[model samples]
Target chain A: MATLAAVIASTHHPFYYKASTAPPEERPPFADEWVAKITAFRETLTRARADVLVMVGSDHFHQLWLDNMPQFLVGKAPFYDANWYNEEREFGLPRMLLRGHEELSSHILRGGLDEGFDLAFSNELRIDHSITCPIITLRPEADLPIVPIYTNIFAPPLPRPARFVELGHAIRRLIDTWPSDLRVAVIGTGHLSLELGGPRQFGPHGPDPEFDRKAVEWIASGDIERALAEVTLDSLWTPGNATHGFMDFMLMMGVAGEGAKADYADSLDLFHTMEAYFTWYPNGVPA
Target chain B: MSKYLLNKFLFTVDRDPDLVERYRSAPHETVAWWESTIANEILNCHGGEASTWLTFDDVEREALAGHDYVKLFELGAHPFLTLTLFIAMFERDYEEPLAFQKEYAARLSHFSLPYPDIAT
Candidate 1:
């Protein structure tokens, strides 16, 4: 059986790559502080010593369109080209090619279908910043083979928060039961309260700081029940138009398990959205 | 309401650098050409399989032609798509980072909770 090395969830802010890498003269004032927090967060994964990563992220209508959108999809290929032209034009993200772990990808796809998820499979997926932001933040080397799982957080008629949680639980179950000697770490990214292309966008803080506060508490404490109780499809709009991305955080909570507190949790309030990072060790802390 | 077509305009143009520039330089002509040529072409499918019923209505066409994001929001076009494409076309005009985005928000400040439905 595979060892679930670490369960990590975070907010994938696209600007982090540019903000952290810009020369001092060109860097934003918040760059140093943001870089420091990300550095410490990166260590959590480093210490886990994961052999492979199961990356969960939402596509921002880059490839998947309303014409054909899937609720949950798994990428089963030997390689995935990351970032899009729009991402480069907007966020200055580097184009990347990530190796795929086809063995585990097949395991999860088969197990997931038997477990009742009509998981969509894509052969050639050009991923956007949702997956790459984490790769940039957590593993700059981008050397590990990954099994990319995309949840439709962008398209409407999206799965409810509860459904996301269920998918997370299923993923955790499948990874734990996979017949393999490799250690796997699962990382997913989401937002707290975001308002993209709306009246409240690019503010000094997230569109709704109050919601961010409670959301961080729910995630860090692994309070799945509380988070699920408060979050609903309709209610998500109140925080910010894009706050539905919070459902991904709920999914990560399900992966971490109910009432299983995080080993490390931290958040930074950036303009437009709150940046959050959390890590959990299911098989105890690695040496 | 052909909200889908409105978003299709934004999505298709946003991805193509040539279309982004074309739309920016000549919104009226670009929207007209797209509606006639590209609007009905089924993405990821062959040209022979193009759909005939995906044309935009007057208001939706005008919104795209005029670059009226305010009207696009009211019509329930996906905000993210609208913003990203708009930023690509207009952000370069601003002196400060996110100035164009902030101005974009200000343009839609009248809208409150329960935003227009973006469901396709």
Candidate 2:
């Protein structure tokens, strides 16, 4: 059976790309610092020798719509051709081919259904910043085969916070049962808070660091009960609508298995949002 | 009206990068195209049980009114679209645009039209 090597949760806001072009002082002080942090993070992945990565992200009305939006969708394509337009492309995002692990993806889809998850499955799905940005930032090489899972965080009728945790646990069960030698890693891409298109979409004021700090502390504490009790939808969006993406973070907690502690956590608060990163080792840190 | 045409408009703009660029570069023209080609078709038919043909011209006129974001939101336009249009149309003066859009969201948050029952 394949081993669950690592579980990482990181922020995926367009501001990372937007800030890359801005003057140094205009961008967050920590923005430039991620190059080093991401490089080190990548080193951990390389050390783990992970072959397949399961990425959990949310769509921004890009590929899905309110007409027929799915609460949870899984990408089952053979490859992902990221379609980046002018502005997104200008942010130094390269158009590249990302490999997709079809067999594992199929297993996950089956497992989700068998486990009674009404998941939306697509064989052809477009990659957006939510899935691409983090990979581009952290795993710049873009070599690993991946399976992308998208949740409906933008539209209404969102799945309960607990539902996301269940999905993660289901994924863990599938990985545990798979009869393969592949070393798999799971990534949850989202953020602390920062509204987009809402009234607070653009601003000079920074994200609520107090909210972010508590989130970090909760995730790092390995106390799922406390995390669940505290990080409700109301509390998550205390900063703004975009903070709802923290459901992705909760999903990662479930993927990290029972007692995953934060191997590392970085809170990078940009001008308008908190682009945070957290890594947890499911099988405990390698001595 | 189904009160979801505005939702469709925002979804279209968000999905199509070229359309977003068009709206950003030429707001009046983009809005005109959407009004004539897109919104007209969607808003013309009464979406309720009764077979009533909506007056598309009146809807278009209301949409064309200058800075009519709040009016549209009140008329069943989704808050996401209204705020997006506000920012896209006037983001050059960033802070003010944010304030304007925020006020619109604040107002809509009180009313229950587009986002009915969707706990935010």
Using TM-score as the measure, which candidate wins? 1
For A1-287, candidate 1 gives per-residue lDDT tens digits of 99999999999999999999998899999999999999999999999999999999999989999888899999999999999999999999999999999999999999999999999999899888999999999999999999999998888888999999999999999999999999999999999999999999999999999999999999999999999899999999999999989998998998999998999999998878889999999999888
Name the weakest run of 10 consecutive residues (lDDT summed) in model 2 chain B.
B111-120
Model 2: residues with Cα > 4 Å off, grouped in runs: A18-30, A86-92, A203-206, B1-3, B14-36, B39-120
Clash pairs detected, candidate 1: none
Distance (Å) between predicted and true CA of A84, model 1?
Answer: 0.5
Report every candidate's CA lDDT: 0.94, 0.69
What's candidate 1's DockQ score?
Answer: 0.90
The CAPRI class of candidate 1 is high
RMSD of each: 0.7, 5.1
| True lDDT of residue B91, candidate 2 | 50
Candidate 1, after superposition: displacement of residue A251 in Å?
0.9
Q: In candidate 1 chain B, where is summed lDDT lowest over 10 consecutive residues?
A: B46-55
Interface RMSD of 2: 6.5
Chain B fold agreement for model 1, TM-score = 0.97
